[model samples]
Target: MAHRLLVCRIWTLSAKEIRCLPASSTAIASTSFSTSLQPSSSQVSFLSPSHGLPRSFTHTTRRQVSFNVQDNEDFTERVINSQLPVLIDFHAQWCGPCKILGPRLEKAVAKQKGRVAMAKVDIDDHTDLAIEYGVSAVPTVIAMRGGDVVDHFVGIKDDDELDSFVSKVIGK
Candidate 1:
């Protein structure tokens, strides 16, 4: 019972869309759901009174919280031209604080639903972007809306602080 409730909660949080289909006798015999944290795909399945699991059920994609900036063009397309507000995380692979803050920031951004998106920029790999953004240190997070900088912070922030910062960025 607890597991069912937990799965429902997670589904409510992560599901982009839910569709109901007629349940089959076989599907009604067992209840199951699948979850994954993979960057490429995440899926959850639940049975409704009228809906049964299909043999070839399609996987629903979760809202992506972490986006790795591939190059200048990718950055421009994903970050600069994004309709949603974007939080750009400029960090280095070796930075201890960046490692600590990355997950926390992602969690904060995830809580925002699709209101905001996060883009990760590796300082070492994207030297030009870092230089252009004036990122002298690691773990620099810049928030932008409509292709313009809005808010930013450097160093590690606690979960609560990150939540507040993200909310502020989205003008919540």
Candidate 2:
């Protein structure tokens, strides 16, 4: 059914999203299966930045996109409902700090995949949410537990600080 395919697509997307994190690459070769993948026809071709080499995707066709506006939508379900603590990156596309914040967010999310759920919002897209949350600035990073706003920081914080905060709040 179409619904099943969409669920599959979403899961595949989630996997690809996870692999995009920086740490996963270093762990790839030790798996021992890296040398055995036969080149397949379904792969899409692209260039690799790290090695300055050409590469092909055996899967994935992620169109350019961003997270949708969420309003009157139960963010509690989206966040607290996760089996893990949740980190929501309140961002607008045009904010400069937001640009700098992404890689770090990705790194954190990668490091805590099963332990945390990461969601992003575009303030421009969700004016209601922006107003409701009193998010007058971009790049506000908030951490939530049990569907409630426990604490948050604006702009960038060192990894150690973030790690410690997560540990304290999530009881890790």
Candidate 3:
């Protein structure tokens, strides 16, 4: 009987057309184990938490944030000459403070949305940039306006402080 049940479960998962099965079969199908093993359907996927709209019908889009600075030339073009104010986060991978502050800063910048942009610089990777910026510490955040350093702060700041910093950088 157990072998028959196993075969039924496998068959049910393989057959995508079988929806609204009998209550007896549903007892097995409703189990968490069977749910994950079921084949994925591309025909209609849900995007919203309520599963309200089909994936194609959803109007939501994502925004880009926290870009990495590739090189000195990239920096000059993206940050220095940018029409919008840029917030540069000077961080090192091994630095604990940097790991903590990076996400917090990104969250704060995201709150301001397109009003400001964030650039992350790895001090170890781009030592020259760090040296040029006079960053002697890990997690140094600098605000740039028109290619010049307008304001800066060192160490970790809470979300509220970061929000305020972003506001000041954008002159809000």
Q: Candidate 1, residue 116: CA error in Å?
A: 0.2
Model 2 ranges off by over 4 Å: 1-71, 74-76
- Per-candidate TM-scores read 0.65, 0.55, 0.68
Stretches of candidate 3 exceeding 4 Å from the true structure: 1-60
lDDT of 1 at 8: 58
Ranked by TM-score, the better of candidates 1 and 2 is 1
Alpha carbon lDDT at 38, candidate 3: 48
The local lDDT score (0 to 100) that residue 16 gets in candidate 3 is 38
Specify the poorest-scoring 10-residue window by lDDT in model 2: 41-50
Per-residue accuracy of model 3 over 1-172 as CA lDDT, tens digit each = 7757755554545233334445555445334223344464422222112443222346867787779999999999999999999999999999999999998998999899799999999999999999999999989999999888999999999999999999999993
Candidate 1 lDDT over residue span 1-172, tens digit each = 8767755544554222333323442243224443345332433344443444334557999878889999999999999999989999998889999989999999999998889999999999999999999998889999998899998898999999999999998883
Worst 10 residues of 1 by lDDT: 13-22
Please name the candidate that would achieve the greatest TM-score relative to the true structure: 3
Local distance difference test values of all predictions, in order: 0.80, 0.61, 0.80
